[model samples]
Target: MLDKVHDLFRLRTSPVIFFVSAGLIAVFVILTLVMPEGMASFWGAGSGWIYDNLGWFYISGLTIFLIFLIIVGFGRFGRIRLGQDDEKPEHSDMSWFGMLFAAGIGTILMFWAVAEPANHFAEPPRGESTGVEARSMEAASEAMGFTLYHFGLHTWTIFALPGLAFAYFIYKRNLPPRVSSIFQPILGDRIHGPIGKSIDIFAIVGTIFGVAVSIGLGTLQIHAGLAQLFGVSDADWNFIIIIAVVTIVATISAVLGVNKGIRRLSNFNIWTAIALLIFVLATGPTVYMLRGTIEWAGVYLSMLPELAFWNDTLADTGWQNGWTIFYWAWTVAWAPFVGIFIARISRGRTIRQFVAGVLGLPTLFTIIWFGIWGSGVFDIEFNGDGGLVDSVLEDGVETALFAFLAEFPLAPVTSAVAIMLVGVFFITSMDSCSLVLDDMCNGYEGKAPLHQRAFWTVAIGTIAALLLTATGEGGLAALQEVALVFGLPFFILGYFIMYNLSRAMREDAGEVGFLRTRRWLQTLPPEEYERRMEEADASLAEAVVAPDYAEGTQPENAPELEHAEQPPVVEEYRVRTGETPIIDPANPGDTGIPPRG
Candidate 1:
């Protein structure tokens, strides 16, 4: 009877959901093209408001997370597994990983790079004025550092590990695959019911909305490019048509599956982005960027302690909240989608690898970015009126990038590349978010089908358009609020993971888990290091399974006897070939292998 009811519900509601999702995206493009910049700002103001209210609450929380990463990152939380069968997943090469991972960062990264430096160049943070002597360089350099500081290593860590935990726990421990699966230690078998479904569905919807608007972010850049290059009217229907065509192409690429199309596209995008960076680094006042980068590093490092922990309570306390807490909240809002997306690709990677990757790679890129572009542009600013940066602040992201580009040697060529890079970056991000949301809808975990992926990817943009219409960007703001609301509570898991990570390491290694100990895993060679991770994972999975999985907690369609017949007839799921390396039960896995097989 329940099966009949579920089938009926799925039949009736599925079509409606898909239809509504599709219809909204087409309308969103139409409306957004016609929507005034004032509306975007009105919505963006909400971003400011969040900054004003609970910004530091997030920063302090993130500060604590940094500590957790340091404590657990060594080797404790490494070696996560996902999936019931010990099947291996296909992984990208180093280049692919670099590119794909980079894609999750939204087009906002490109838009902000130009816009923010401009804003700071005019009125530096802390209300510092740039006199004729003060020069915009000082202001711009400071802005870059702060931006990098926030988005750098610290932010990605928060977004990534939760997915790692979820995927690893579900796949390896034989627990239900859902966001709540990570909480099985707390929720037990209850992780399999309505609450779990809601959590997964909510994550799906939230990510769709998030990525949808994010796709829309590229619209502005595209408009900017068109307006500047072809002298096309950004406000006209032509712009919308162009965006539709471009976005469709990107969506199609996603439909081609992760390893083939998405992977190749990301690989290209990251390489070009890096090429752009290298171009600037090599030609853009190399000496100044190097010196300024060192200073930025010092400021970043010295202030790192303060930057992570600052919760100012004094006058203009609003300033503290606006930036810090806003970032934290924004980070949380971004967490589920980014986490899930990263987690999907992160199979075969250990928790240590994930934490380090999230916390290290992005930060490295950000620092180099600030050092190169941020410092180079600021040097130009210091020498003159800093008009490039000034325009970025007064105008918008598009104009700012153009204005800054004008200062370089091959301004026109680089500008073209920058324009291309922005669009590519947006699409890469779009596909990634879409893929993550599809996983949410699959009602199973890990690699979902390409068809579901394409549907959700395009659906996300459509929904964002509609929601943006409904909330007038207030919807986007609302999404941020939702993220914060969801994220603030997840701190418990972060804490629990951190605590367990530390305890397990200490006990396993006897006295060696202590940092001062000679056998700290960090000191091991790469091969030996990995062996240790396998062992640790096997051990942890056993402990986790007895309590969490020892209970009957299979999903309705999980390939267990209960529902093994109904193997999620996915029209477009991917099976990663090499990454998921099944632990051979014949060998009973490494000493640390989980009970996934």
Candidate 2:
């Protein structure tokens, strides 16, 4: 009985990672519960210091990641398959994109699609420099651009670089599917030592805090929906209840594993989100949204350079701290979780294909999502109906989307759908996060026990519930600060990961030469390609040695092979004869090579 209990809870691998991370999170939750104000103040101060000192680093780091991915995706190394040279992708493109969109930023988009743009429109950034005043046409245009800037390619690139590294290392090289595995090229054996353990620890901790932030946000939005729909009061107990229910659902989904649970939920999330989006476009100001979406793309492209690197050094408006830096920090914090999750599902995809799907498709979808939603809110605010912005600013940001929907027809029905969307998005994010946490804790071996996944799901929900209940009015702010603080270490870790991945790819390219014709090789008739390969092999065989040599003996002209290593001969024999040598396990001394005919 005791053994069963121990087996149920024990982490078979990387127990240190599990214990230390669990301990730290336990301590944090305890302190927050004991003194919520103190913890909140500490997080706030820590967040401020990071933003003031390292905000520029955050901005510059993400920009560099974006540029690096673009170059690698289109560069010569693009043809390198993440798995074997001939392996195909595991999931279909539709399911792949669904998981990517659902895991990466689904909840964020749902929560902020209406609120962020509304906030930006009400108060545009750099009015002194860009001359885009608040609540004007210029502000509205700038708003969508900034929205896209925050949620677009730059953000996805953060996830892409890490995902690419994980896939390349885990699938191609057969490394363990941990964040530290990406460092194997540089760390070598040290990856299994204290250094590697430390890296995984950071990943686990950061992923928890990052995921808790989203869960907390989703909880808030869920509460707001409930309050609107069923007159549920905004109480601490209700928040806990919301988190409890969602966590239970997420745990069940997680226990069902990725294909059975996460993939289906993700597909449902995308379809439902799209249905809601199309309903908004169809019901309200269709032409304006259609036109604004095109202009939004242009404005995003035009302003991307400035927004990508904007530090606000000249004026020091402190705007970036709350918006850009916060979003970037949230994204950085999410990198390991989303990166690992995407990499887990991205087996057999080429680096170029992974980059294109992970970075491009979701970005395009985000632009359309925000364009329609942002256009709706902008139209409302611009027409002298300030209720949506006022509710967001005064009432609460969580209620912004429901309030915006309230303006349209079937307010109750659309609001219910929005609530359901947030709930499912919540479940998908939590379940995926818990699964990744399980992988990180267990060193990415076979499936972890179901209880382990459930434990993580519970831990995440507990942290989010504690933050919301303890911090009271400042719960969301505290969640953001936690994301900002935990994100810094991982953000710094990303550079090392990038360096290691690039160096390894370059070394691989040198060994294999350029794989530019890898795809072209596929275009040829299989018979033709096989014939050409056979002819080339025959020529190489002649240049080396005659293929008539008996097993365990050298040909007369190859006398230099007398002192040469033995394994290369075996390899050459196999390549020439198209047969792998098999040794008898019982005999121990019998060479498995057959006598030449």
Q: Largest lDDT belongs to which candidate?
A: 2
lDDT, candidate 1, 251-346, per-residue tens? 887777567666777778778877887787787788877897777777677757656665555435355554556556545655676766676676
Residue ranges of candidate 2 with Cα displaced over 4 Å: 1-11, 384-386, 473-479, 510-597
lDDT string for model 2 (1-597, tens) is 433444576634455777788888888777777777777798999988998888899888889998989889888778888876778999999899889977888888988988988888888887777787888899888888888999999889889989998887766655666787778666654555688778888888878888888888788899999999999997789999999999999999999988999999989888888998999999998999899888899999999998888899998999888888888887888799899899989998888898888989999999899988998898888764667887898877889999999989899999999998899888988999988887776665344667777898899998898888877656556666777888888888778878988876664443334342111101111122233233332222212211111233222332221221223433534333332224333442344334445
Error of 2 at 93 (Å): 1.1
- What's the TM-score of every candidate structure? 0.73, 0.85
TM-score of structure candidate 2:
0.85
User: Candidate 2, 424: how far from true, in Å?
Assistant: 0.8
> Who wins the TM-score comparison?
2
**How high a TM-score does candidate 1 get?**
0.73
> In angstroms, how far off is 589's CA in candidate 1?
28
RMSD of 1: 10.5
